[model samples]
Target: MPALDDLSLLIEAARRSGEIATSFTGKTAQRWDKPDDAGPVTEADLAVNAMLHQTLTAARPDYGWLSEESDDGTRRLGQRDLFIVDPIDGTRSFIEGSDTWSHSLAIARDGRITAAVVFLPMLDRLYAAAAGAGATLNGQSISVSDIATLPEATVLATKPVMEMQHWTKGDPGFKRAHRPSLAYRLGLVGQGRFDGMVTLRKSWEWDIAAGALIVTEAGGQCTDRTGQPLRFNNPDPRLNGVVAGGDAVHAALLSGLAQTQATP
Candidate 1:
């Protein structure tokens, strides 16, 4: 476990970054695009990235850094502690003047996440968790809902046509709701706002590293669609797939999807 001082410092840094992101939410000039047609990246993202990189590097000078807006450097592999970050996890929503986006931060030790913070600046909600200490939203402890069945679950989904095809063909009873950002969807699960969330595409480490810990500590399960635990610091840095929710709801989801596939 990290010292309280260290965690507090990280939290403060994240809060500061969140404030930077919020300052550009409704502004028109901060939005831009990343190279390689990767989608949008805003001035707010770069600003927050610079802020986080500076603060975290200053705090733990030895830790390697990985972030959405920065180039990847393998130097992090030699260090036991590394900072993985997404300055703006939902840049599209941020650019569109919506409040669904957020800032995601996590510390990985030896390839496992040891601590995480997902801050939604527009909502003034901060979700934080340290290993073995549980998770919290805005200083209040949070957890997943007790829904146990697919029919009873309120599923947050992405890319409607694709994800819906994957789910409906696999589970007739499962219901779906749409949310764009993976971090926001997972945060909702942690806060008990949604019963579960499913994403079918490969997501970046910065996208789910913090969100996974948030859901796990909130008494929900987060794993690859194959029901395996998630690992970080990979060379690819992309999660293959994600299935997250309360224990029983997660189990029911896996079973329902499997049964639907097996029938006929």
Candidate 2:
């Protein structure tokens, strides 16, 4: 099972993981929130996380593992390559019978993601990408839209992000939309279903690692809200936020973010 050369094993593992996740979808499973306020987790999450650990780690024994469902082991910081995963990206949406959740997976080497996969079981859409290999949705090549600039761009964001002030140009208006799953939002952007996506709140690496690469591989730009490049597998494994999509829209979002942050 040493298929970790590129995204081969990761993609394979993701498909299998998707099966595990789907088995629990719409089921009456155990659930609760974390004391750390890390949000909700269900028995499905634990089961899927265990399956991924068994399947992926057995294939890449040396690869470090960083998963939202797994405890952070400081020893992983010593590994050169790491697996970052979110067994179920939209737990809330999934529990509510929504179709936005997905199994998210990615590999990071030296803090840079090189391979990624996002599998939406209910939608039967699989988004995959590798460094220099480009991005694909359901085996079809994908790329971001050419649309640039806000107000005209169609974006996926929360209400707060929409209400925020824009730059000197004015309220960075855009056709605002919302999605519960951060990973799915990025996947949509990568698939050109949206012109771009943004969030002004802290996000987990497991939530964006795979999506970030998929967007970039699809010819989109991705970075923190501050416009800094995203790097994964850090000890904290949490970034401030994400602003990703087509080139012009990405720049516009970052510009607006800078202005809003500068507000008193």
Candidate 3:
């Protein structure tokens, strides 16, 4: 099937996942931390994950599955095509009644994401992209900002990423901000709402897979902290870190990060 066809499949699945998630809103949904301090999960996340797994795998049985809420096994490693999914990208935000949580989904073929969707249902913001087909927000085309320098950039990141330890020559002086959902942060960058986003901590494939494609299709760059291209569905299912932005700003961020390592 074509990438766009797969993108359509993901779009519908994400919207339906949104519907399932909202049903848990305004009510107390069971929430608990995962093993090894992996963060929280709620009843809504499981519900949405079950629906997406059943529906999507039914439509494409030949494909493999890798979902945040599902058990990780080597079965997916044997397949050429895989579904990478995050039922809810911001469970803490959802538990706190924030409307910014999102459903992140992607189709990866041979370690490359071919179709991707990051849907913020509460905000009614749907970001979709097919490899080489560009990106969209609610069916309208979207792209990253033209800002070429970090000092003039606005970035989405946690406060710790802005500390002096992360930069060699001191702060880069870009406006820094935070968003609970890593997927949403990437989508906002693709939509030109922010010039870039960075996270130096190891990241999960489900959290960054869809947004990585969205940023790339939107004429931006999405890579690890070392400026290496992102490849999904690895045996480990994790990345060194993430740094995404328009080309120039991406380069600047990587350069500074490399300097930090060389310092002290």
Candidate 4:
């Protein structure tokens, strides 16, 4: 199928999943965490997972599946194309009544993402992208911020990671803040609302896959803090961390990350 065909499918499934998610937001739902302490998963997450699995699988059984709420089997490793998903990217935000949660979905072939869609139900905004095609918000095209440096740049990052201790040169003095949703944080960077986003903990593929593509397609860059490209559908679907921003800033940010992560 064409890239747009895959994109269309992702957008449809994301919107449908977003609708299902909205229904359970204000209502009560069962919630729990994995024995491994991965994070919380609510009834809404499972419901959306099932709906999206059915929606995508029924249309493309040959495609493999990788989902936050589903079992991670070895089957996906052999498929040429697969779906990477987070039923709801920000369960914490969603449970807290924050509107930043999202339904993040993407299609990856080989090791690269080809199509993606992120839907924020409460905000009524949809972000979508197809390989070699520009990104869009709702229906209009979007791009990363033009800001070329970090001084006073609006950034999304965990407090400690953004601290002066990590910056060897001195704190970049970013206008930093925390965003509960990883996907939404990335989406914000893609929308030019944030100059950059960073994290220093392990990041799941399902959490960053869609957002990575969206950020890149928006004329920004995304990769592990060590300056490595993110590849999906691997036996291990997690990354050490991610840093994303427009070209010049992204390069500079990586240098800071290198110093921060460097051993004393």
Give the better candidate number (3 or 4) by TM-score.
3
Off by over 4 Å in 2: 1-4, 25-27, 165-170, 259-264
Which candidate number would show the highest TM-score if scored against the true structure?
3
Candidates, ranked, TM-score: 3, 4, 2, 1
Local lDDT at 12 for model 1: 95
The candidates, ranked best first by lDDT, are 3, 4, 2, 1
**Over 4 Å off, model 4:** 259-264
Looking at model 2, which ten-residue stretch has the lowest summed lDDT?
255-264
How high a TM-score does candidate 3 get? 0.96
Off by over 4 Å in 1: 1-4, 25-27, 159-171, 258-264
Extract clashing residue pairs from model 1: none
Question: Which structure is stronger by lDDT: 2 or 3?
Answer: 3
lDDT for each residue of candidate 3 in 1-264, tens digit (9 for 90 to 100)? 599999999999999999999988624889888999888999999999999999999999999999999999999999999999999998999999999899999999999999999999899999999998999999999999999898899999898788887887789879998899999999999999999999988899999999999999999999988888998889999888899999998888888874333111
C-alpha-based local distance difference test score of model 3 = 0.92
Question: Poorest 10 consecutive residues of model 4 by lDDT?
Answer: 255-264
Q: Which candidate has the top score in lDDT? A: 3
What TM-score should be assigned to candidate 4?
Answer: 0.95
lDDT of 4: 0.87
Model with the higher lDDT, candidate 2 or 4: 4
